[model samples]
Target: MTQNLQYFLIPFMDWRIMLLLWGGVFAGIWVGAIPGLSGTMAVSLLISFTFSWEINDALAVMCGTFVGAVYGGAITAILLNIPGAPAAIATGMEGYPLAQKGEAGKAIGLCTTVSLFAGFVGVAALAAAAPIIARFALKFSPRDFFLLAVMGILLIGSIGGGDPIKGIMSGTVGILISMIGMDPSTGELRYTFGSLNLMAGISFVTAMIGLFGVSEALTQFRTSGAKSPKQNLTKVIPDWPTFKKYLPLAVRSSLLGVFIGALPGTGGDVAALLAYDQAKRTTRNPETPFGHGAYEGLVAPETANKGAIGGAFIPMLTLGIPGDAITAIIIGALFIHGLRPGPMLMIETPHLFWMIVSMLIIANVALFVLGLLSVRPFAKIIEIPKSIIMPIIIILSVIGTYAIQNSVVDVFYMTGFGVLGYFMRLYGYATGPMVLGLILGPMLDSNYRRTMQIAEDRLFPFVSGFFTSPLSFFLTASIVFMLFSQTKLYRKWRGIE
Candidate 1:
């Protein structure tokens, strides 16, 4: 443990590593702030570039990018009414309203300060509790995972806010869309209409950019002479009293972010939305207002979003399962370096895990510094002509989608999803559920099938699990409670139950 702590503190010990890590942080912030560019894309692209580097160096760059990108998304969310990443969708709901009110700088400051604090909470949680959480997570089986996925799906109530039914429909559509590729069980085509390219399924990143980026750009064009909101930078520092009031909420959101982030198939977006919902529920007085410029609103999502960085690494390091897309990309990086991430990783490369933790610490600090000094500059980006900005967004979306695999088919898929996204939004549907479903659908399908296969081989043990194992029983109960909680009958019975 003492030796492991040494690795966790290595970035502090080595100035060169810390400098390189911070450099990546700066680059990631800029990349992620741009519309249509994502942290996942940035990290994935970096993998090829870092292929020749040492394992630790490669990981440092990836961690920096991950940390920076998560926070970077909020910049666009606040200034442009566009979420740079899906995790920032919640941020846009509240942050944009603040921007419209000419408090972009203050909002950015509040979010930045809380984001840094939340990142620390997440890292601290991971450092202290990863092994324990991993142990608990190991007890969950496919049924539990499936139920958890359903719970995630049900979260659209808070995510959608305006219309719960629309959220459900959107999530269902996302699940259906997720089924577009090859069938998990039979390896046969399901929704692909005989096109060779369609067999692989829709790209989530393209869909995200289309739904949140291009669609938003199109919406912007509908209003002529839309001047960029005047962004004032006079008060870019967080007030102490305001900070003190929300510190508890920030801590709670950060913890929630970590917990949700550690769960395989659930990522930062869900964590952010969940944190937002919880914060809204717990607020005694949401300053600025709930959905429009509320300081708590920015704090909740921003904290949870950044905190999710550490939370996401828990399962990745302990179980070799990625908690999010960015970590999935990191897994590839690890494999390329002949490093396996799992329980064995803890045993074999304990130092590597600690290095990642250290990288996160440095990256968060770097993000704080960069975000503080650069808030004004970033807010100024909103002043650029939409005609110029939107076109660039479209081009970047095209390039980023193609860069995934150099496939032209992805470009067409992206355009198709963009069209679909436009329609979905028109019908009052929330895109967050769609993003969540797309991410978790494949994971649920594969795991459920594997569990069933194993069950058939040992029916007695599988059946007995519900009665014999406390973990299984608790998970089953939780699923039942979640399902019941979402029903009209339960709602009426409990009068908003």
Candidate 2:
């Protein structure tokens, strides 16, 4: 293991790779802190640009970007009350309140520290568990995959915070939108409306940008004249006692991040939200308040989001299944280099796998420095007049959507979706579930059809088998109980449940 580890850490020893790695970190932070841009967009754009680069170099750059972008989102979330990525939505809840109270710098400091710690845990988990955990994950079948997707979708309802019905509705809409492309089972088109671009369906990246970036731009127009929050960024370091207090939540959230990340289809956004909720539930006494300027609130989500990086690599390395979208892109890069990631990858490309692990460590370190420097200067983002920011965001969204496939039709689709997002937000619906549904719907649809085909002779038996599977049973119970608890009847019966 030590010998293999050295091969992975070689990138760190090479000054050239280290410089490029850190450069990516800086780039990711700047891009992600911008209102209309996100880590996924940055990574996707990089993938196309780095097509000619060496596989290791391409991956090392992405590793840094991933780390920096996830943390960078919190900067904007704290300072501007706008999340740069969906992963920072939870951060915004506590982060904005802190900003309002003139504690933006403190919130950013704690979030950065926790994010760095969580990144280390995630990288360590990937290093220690990838071989063994991947083997276990490989045991999953199509049915397991379908169930996994469903479980991920269910989290939208959980994380919507106060409105489960709105969350579920948003998720349904997302699923329907994802179904617009050509059918997977047959060649028939579903909802292309005679347009050739719609034949490929709405790009997830485009939909995400429309839902977050574009919708946000519209909202900014409403608050165009509102004053930016006042700030006192002098006290940046988190106090010693405050740091000690958040340590437990950070560790606990990091553990949750690892498990959720290890699961197929689930990603950092879901992991972070779940961790945030858990931290709220676990607090015996309010330190600052759960939703308003709470330190733990920032710590939990920031930790979990970063921690998910390692956990996401588990299935990607061991089972040849990419754990999330970014990993899916990384898999493509591997294939381009004539390397296959799977069980044999351990024996055939052990060095490459290790190198990724080490690269993750370097990325995390870069994020720490970038995160700290980013906090003070980033606070000024909110000072940019909304009149200027909104138009710029809209322009960027148009460009990004059009660039996806070099099709103008996508611009129309993005605009339509942006309007949809605006109304959804106006009605107090959470967009998290919608994004989750978009990601998981295809996996669920295909896996369900495949599982049913496999169990043709034993339909009822197949349906009954999931009841005996521990994971399926646990998830089923969790979803059911969660839904039940959200009902008024359950709330009444439980005396404020």
Give all candidate RMSDs, comma-separated: 3.7, 3.6
Residue range 162-194, candidate 1, lDDT tens digits: 688888788777778888878968998988889
Cα lDDT, all candidates: 0.79, 0.77
Query: Top TM-score: which candidate number?
Result: 1
Error of 1 at 288 (Å): 4.9
Give the per-residue lDDT of model 2 (tens digit) for 369-391: 87788777776655567777678
Off by over 4 Å in 1: 1-9, 318-322, 328-344, 347-350, 423-427, 443-497
The runs of at least 3 residues in candidate 2 whose Cα sits more than 4 Å from the true structure, single-residue gaps closed, are 34-56, 79-82, 161-164, 280-295, 335-340, 457-459, 481-497
Q: Where does the lowest 10-residue lDDT sum fall in candidate 2? A: 153-162
User: What TM-score quantifies how close candidate 1 is to the native fold?
Assistant: 0.86
Residue 313 in candidate 2, Cα distance off native in Å = 2.4
Candidate 2 contains a number of clashing pairs equal to 0
CA displacement after TM-score superposition, residue 452 of candidate 1 (Å): 5.8
